[model samples]
Target: MILVSYFARYREQLNLGGEKLPLDASLNTVDDIRQRLIARGGVWADIFSESNLMCAVNQDLCRLDQAVEDFDEIAFFPPVTGG
Candidate 1:
């Protein structure tokens, strides 16, 4: 299983903090996982469709193409800004 988390605005928007997803061969990369979520349509698709969406794997910031493995933790959030 892979742990998936939504933070800040994403958490509020999705009304979720995290979930455990079944790991599968098709979920090879962060992008792959994202695409799968997007395929869910509606809110799932809308939240992930943001071009400026940020992500991390096991707490380390990474690109969407970054490889993913079973039991890894993934986090998604919107870009942050400082005043």
Candidate 2:
């Protein structure tokens, strides 16, 4: 299984903290997982459509192309800004 999490605005927007998804061969990378979520349409599509969306794998910030493995933790959030 893959543990997917949403942080900050993403969590609030989705009204979800995280979820576990069954591991699948088709979900080879972070982008693939994202595409899966986006495929859900509606709010899922809208939230993931942002070009500035950020991702992390196993607590390490990574690109969308980052490889995903079973039992890995994936997180998504918007870019951070502070004064």
lDDT of 2 at 46: 94
Q: Which regions of candidate 2 fall more than 4 Å away from where they truly are?
A: none
lDDT of 1 by residue, 1-83 (tens): 99999999989988999999999889999999899989989999999999999999999999999999989999999999999
RMSD of each: 0.7, 0.6
Global lDDT of each model? 0.94, 0.96
Model 2, position 76, has a per-residue lDDT of: 98
Candidate 1 residue pairs that clash: none
Using lDDT, give the best candidate's number: 2
Could you estimate the TM-score for every candidate? Answer: 0.96, 0.97
Worst 10-residue stretch by lDDT in candidate 1? 9-18
Question: How big is the positional error of residue 53 in model 1, measured in Å on the Cα after superposition?
Answer: 0.6
lDDT of 2 by residue, 1-83 (tens): 99999999989989999999999889999999999999999999998988999999999999999999999999999999999
Off by over 4 Å in 1: none
